[model samples]
Target chain A: MRINRRRYLTQKVAKILIWMAALSTMGVMALIVLQVLSEGIPVLSPRFFLESPRSMGREGGIFSTIIGTIALTVVAIVVATPLGVGTAIFLGEYTREGRISRVIRFGIGCLAGVPSIIFGLFGFVFFVIYLNMGWSILSGGLALAAMILPTIICTAEEALKAIPYSFREVSYSLGGTKWETVTRAILPNAMPGIFTGIILGVCRSIEETAVVILTAGSSLIIPTSLFSPVRTMSVHFYILAREGISMEMAYGTGAALILLVLFVNIVANWRLNRYIRKRA
Target chain B: MSAIPSSPLKAEVKKLNFYYNLVQALNDVNLPIAEKRITALIGPSGCGKTTYLRCFNRMHDLYPGNRYEGEIILYPDQLNIISPKVDPIEVRMRISMVFQKPNPFPKTVFENVAYGLRVRGEARRNLLEEKVEKALKQAALWEEVKDRIHDLAFNLSGGQQQRLCIARALATNPEILLFDEPTSALDPTATSKIEELIMQLKKEVTIIIVTHNMQQAARVSDYTAFMYLGEIIEFDKTDKVFTHPSIRLTEEYITGRFG
Candidate 1:
């Protein structure tokens, strides 16, 4: 009876400690969100989103930066999705676990751990200087694509692995070729997971400032073409805060960025849940 | 060797050997699959019964380093199904399989049944509907699923899902249907239902089954091959093999003495 009471007391203490840790984590997130939203919400007027900045960002709005962010992100996603997904398929399906596959996986693991600032440096050198792309959306977008490739490949590969091996066998026994099996039996089932990866890539692209600033120049004008230089919202926020240009505008941009990321995550999770429910 | 069946031959496996990398999984196995008849392969666990059954459709080719020796000759054409020259896809086109566990695609019941047809590039809406309906009916699942044909296959009961897999296999009108412990994951009622379906299906296609259940081999198979240690120790009529002693190992396994 004494031992049982001691065990119960220990369990209570452990539970309270864990509960405190979780509550503190939540507390930090709530504080950050509340601080940003309180300062930035009032600045989000219709004109702020519709008009271009003027007088070196001291007046007017940040319409051009929004367009720039969209264009750069579009270029990044369009280039990255196929390449990442294809690489994942090739790695997961075409090759057996051998020395070559192991080496390739090791390379991807190393790439995933590289800092984004290194990506910025590489983009500045290879894309801007060597390729003569100059400071443009194409350069920055390609750099962002490379930054997100490892994330997409790793997630997509995991999703592919989650499918039962029997599904492949069933497809093969039904006379379906490897390509047919992947497209019909495998990809359709893995779509939700793959979409989640893409969503993650989008979030990374939106939040990224270093790579965009170095490769895609901070042009205040909205981009007219893929080759045109433009400023993304995050880059705008970074410059505003760093140069002491406009603290209010920086907070406003930070709020928009947070809201966008949260929205994407929520929508992606909801869709994934629906898909799992339907399959179940 | 036992006397060959009097029925016309659908395929012949002659001195067949199979290897997985350096490991030999099937040794010098030979069997005759009679046309439109059921042949059952019975064995203790790890005796390579499923390995032999997979040879009929070149399933081992999907992986690296697995190799096949000798011939699995399909009758009429006399084509060696296991030859390196024959594409695995071509071999697979003529054969379909039902797995040990029910493996319905994460699709609607209609789509699950229609997958094989779609893979074969059959695109006419009316023809797809007809074939899907016919195959589902042939598998004895059409009546229960007719209304909810559009519903996801995962919603079906375990027995119904297995039947749906059978229907999916049947949709392509394969020349040979391979069953790799198709009913092992099911209950007694489902197992009996699957046995009945297999018996009925032999009128249209040749069948090669790998079963763990001795009673199942006795009930549904026209011919039975008892395998031990990756070798076929006895092959004969199911009744004769079950009732009479051909080899000590066969008798021992049949009488529940030892595997």
Candidate 2:
């Protein structure tokens, strides 16, 4: 295994290229975080959080948008988590070799690849227009749930795959049935990955605006029911930025959106680290 | 040792043929496992010794595309165990297995041993504690692990993990115990310890062990069955099998001429 001069030179080049690619991206993320923090800090106050959405010059807040985003995310989590985890279990445990499983997997891949605006168009026609839901929170949540289902399913499947087969064998040998083994052993072992999947799904859903904008109308008042019109943080930011609002409000809202995304990533990373520690 | 029946031929197999897909893993294998004694199945890799041992309790049924045709008769009762309706779980409960590699459940030492009892609905705190302690003592692991009964089983050395597996098997009070190359993954010291444990355990449970180590078979087993090409070449008392095998293949395998 002696290294020649040519090989050594190539190795050095490869190392530099790898670091360059990694550091460049890391630097961009850090710069974005710093920019958001420096700009958004002055705009955020305890009172701002409590107030409702309103036009500037007249005075306004993001209360309705915040509540709507929370509601949409909660519904999405409930809908996606079970379906995603169950699909993961089926792929990991029951699927050995089959055309159907392959088809299902390819379908998920294509679903994830579909553009958000296209999804918005479909939701706008299917749920909001044809179903006559009339810009409702339920319609928005279901649309977002559809958008993020692929994320949850893929991550959860990987987590289930990461678990050792020996654990399953041990459980079976001890007379644990398939369902018992899945719930007690497989799911517990894959919890970190599953949690990561969920958080990522939530983050992606929250960051999306096109789909929410079409399904959940730009109502400034707080949504009292699922059928009522609502607005999310992303949609609010979009409306504010596009409608020629004061530059300060637009920049501040953008920064707030960035912070929200960062918060979700942090929680997901913590869960992932905890899972890795357990595995180790 | 005193608890085991003195009778010989506790379990018997007849005309057993095991196939993995179209490839035959075992062919018309018949043998008797005596009570209160160790029977070692010795051969090279792919010789079907492990496969044959797995058939005693139908562990082979775990895999798809595997088919077995034969009668396995349990002595005294003369039970025909090859029927598809026979529950593999019940068979496993009565005849426990120690895998080739040490596989302790990812749990505390106490939980690992008590797993078998708990599966059968034995949840009394006092009884569960006593069984865990007794099984550990039987496997000669009590002295090393008694203080850390609550410690994770994965933290132990390979030998300790193997013993813990043995202890887990013993907790079920199986009438027969199967070992599939139990010491192949262990060091010399651990191998010797497991060998000693096997010798001690044979006094109560019928033992059927698979081994690549000829010396281990000679040292611990009462009888040895030599297999090659998925067929038994010779089977007799351990001394006779080593000293004067009936088949040339058996002699060559025993003499380390080929695997």
Candidate 3:
């Protein structure tokens, strides 16, 4: 009876500790969000979203930065998706687990762990200077694409692996060529997973600052073409806060960035759920 | 081997051997498949029945280092199907398979039934619809799934999914249908329904089924090959093998004395 009581007491203590740990994590996230939203929400207005910034962002709005962010992100995603997904398919389907595949996987793992600042440095050297592209969306976008390729490849490969081998067999037994089996049987089922990876790449591209500032140039002007220099919202926020220009605008930019990420995640999850339901 | 079917030969396996890398899976497998008839392979687990069945469409070729020796000669053309010169895709176009599990593609019921036809370049909408309907009816699943034809194949019950696989395999009107334990994953009712469907299908196409259940072979097969340890112990008429055994090993296995 005494031992049982002690055991019950230990269980109660462990439960409380776990609950405390979870509550603290949630508390930290909530506090940060609340702090930013409290200072930022007041600055948001229709003009703030629609008009371009003036006088080094102390006046007017952040319209130019928003366009720059969208353009850079679009370029990054467009370039990255095919290369990443194709690499994943080739790695997962075309080759067996051999020394070459292992080396490639190791290279990808190393790439994933490399710091974002190194990507910025590489982009500044290879694309901005060496290629003489100057400060442009194309250079920054290519840099961002390289940074996110490993993420997309790893996730897409996992999704392809999750599919049953029997699906391939069914396709083959139906007289499908290898390419046909991949397109018809494998790729369709892997779409949701691939989409998730693309979304992650988008999120990373949107918030990235070092690569954009170094290669794309932190110009406040709205970009006219791929070759035009521009500023993204995250870069804008970093400059505002670090240069002691406007903490209010920085907070506002930070809040908008958070909201954008959240919206993208919610829409992606909803679409994925609807697709899964229809298939189920 | 002594009791060859009286029907015309569809394919013949001569001195066939199979290997997964260095591990020999089938050894000296010789059998004759009759046209428009059902031939069932019965054996213990890992006895090479499914491996032997897979050789028909060169499924073993999909993986590296898996090798096939000797010939599987198809009739009329008399071409060696397993030869490196003959494309596996061409052989697969002439033959189709229904797996042990209900492996319906992640597609709608109608699309699942129409996949093989589309693979063969059948595109006209009206033709696809007609052929899909005919295949579904042939598998005896048209009435149950007609209203929900656009619904996902995964929404169907286990038995219904298996039938959909059958319809998918039958869509291209394959000359031979290979079943790798089609009913092993089903309940008794579903099993009986599949058995009935298999028996009925033999009138139109040559069938090579691998089954673990001895009774299933007896009920649906015209000829039965009993395999043990990667070799065929006996190949004879179903009734004769089940009743009047000529080999002691075959008798022991049929009477449930040992595998």
Candidate 4:
């Protein structure tokens, strides 16, 4: 009876600890959301969103910043999606488990761990100095693309791996060539997972600040072309907050970024789930 | 027991042995698969009947760590299907396979049947539609799925999925079809439906089925080969194999003495 009581007490204690842990994690995120809302909600207005900033961002809006963010993300996706997905397919399908595949996998793993600032420095040197691109959207996009490539490749490979081997067997048994099998059976089924990776890359590129600041020259002027200097919302926010330009606008930018990510994640996750269900 | 009519040769497997690296999976296997007939390969689990069936299409070549010896000679030219000179893809085109579990490509029902046709250079839309319809009808699934042809293959029930896989195999009109325990994962009604389909299908394509169910072997097959420990113990008409097995081991297995 005593032992049973002791066991029950231990179980209750463990349950309480689990609840506390979950609540604490939620509490921290809630605190961040609340903080951002408190600091930024009053600053949100049509003018704040639609008008260009003036007097070194002490007034006006982030219209140019929004355009810059969109352009940079588009360029990043254009650069990264094909390259990352191709590498993933090659790793997952085209090659056998050997020294070369192992080395490539190890390199990707290391790349994933590398600091984003290092990518910033590399972009600054390779694009700004060597190539003389000089702080353009193209330079920033390329650096961000490099930053997200490892993650996309890793996720895409895992998604490809998740497909049942039986799919390939069925394709081959029906006389599908390796290429036919990939396109018809393996790749089609792997689409949702691949999309998830691409979406993740987009989110990463959208939020990245250091790479944007270093490679994409900070300009208050709206970018006219890929070669022109641009500034992302994240870089704008960082400058506004750290340089004491405008805390109100900075917090507003933070709120917008958070909402954008949340909206994207919810929509993408729903679509992905639906697609998987339809296939399954 | 029903008498099996005499049929011409379809495939001739001679002294074929298979290895997965150092371990031998098949040993000196010799069997003749007759044309337009259902030949059932019956044995306990791990008896290598599925392994032998896969050899007909050279499905063994897909993965590494697998090795083959001797020859599987198909009809007409009696070409050794296992030779490196003969493309494995071409071999699979002539000889198709259906696995134990139903594996329908995650596409529309129409597309699933059309996949085999598409792979072999059938690109004309009207022709593809007609062939897909014919194959689905041949699989005995058309009546049930005809209305929703564009629905995803995954929407079908398990039995329907298995039949769709059969239709996928039949789409290219292969000379031979290898079924690796095709109905093992199905219910009794679905199993009977597939068995009936197999019997009906023998009027065209030659059938080689690997089965663990003795009753299934008895019902659908014209010829039954009992395998044990990687070697075929008896190969004879289904009636003879079941009613009067020559080998004690086969008799023992059929009589429920041991697997």
Q: Give the alpha carbon lDDT tens digit for every residue of B57-120 in model 1.
A: 9999988899999999998799999999999899888889999999999999999999999999
Looking at candidate 4 chain B, the ten consecutive residues that score lowest on lDDT are: B1-10
Candidate 3 C-alpha lDDT tens digits along A99-140: 989999999999999999999999999999999998999999
Ranking by DockQ: 3, 1, 4, 2
Q: Which stretches of candidate 1 lie over 4 Å from their true place?
A: A1-10, A274-280
- Please identify which of the two predictions, 1 or 2, would achieve the higher DockQ against the true structure: 1
DockQ computed for model 4 against the true two-chain complex using alpha carbons: 0.78
| Model 4 regions lying over 4 Å from their true place | A277-280, B1-6
Tens digit of per-residue lDDT, candidate 2, span B1-259: 0112235788877788889999988888777777878989999998888888878777666668889898888767777666687777777767788888998866789988987787787889999999999999999999999898998888999999999999998988988888989999999999999999999999889899999899999999988888887787777888788897878888888889999
Q: For each prediction, how big is the interface RMSD?
A: 1.1, 2.6, 0.7, 1.2
lDDT by residue for model 2 (A83-178), tens: 888888898787765897999899999999999987888889998999998898888887888888889999999999898887766656665556
Per prediction, fnat is: 0.86, 0.19, 0.81, 0.86
Clashing pairs in 1: none
**Positional deviation of residue B219's Cα in model 4 after best superposition, in angstroms:** 1.7
Which candidate's DockQ is highest?
3
The TM-score of candidate 1 is 0.96
Instruction: Using lDDT, give the best candidate's number.
Output: 3
In model 2, how large is the Cα lDDT of residue A182? 83
Rank all candidate structures by their lDDT, best first, as comma-separated numbers.
3, 1, 4, 2
Mind giving the per-residue lDDT tens digits that candidate 3 earns over B156-230?
999999999999999999999999999999999999999999999998999999998999999999999999999
Q: Between the candidate structures 1 and 3, which one is better when assessed by DockQ?
A: 3
Candidate DockQ scores, in order: 0.81, 0.37, 0.86, 0.78
**Which candidate has the top score in TM-score?**
3
Q: In order, what lDDT does every prediction score?
A: 0.92, 0.83, 0.93, 0.91
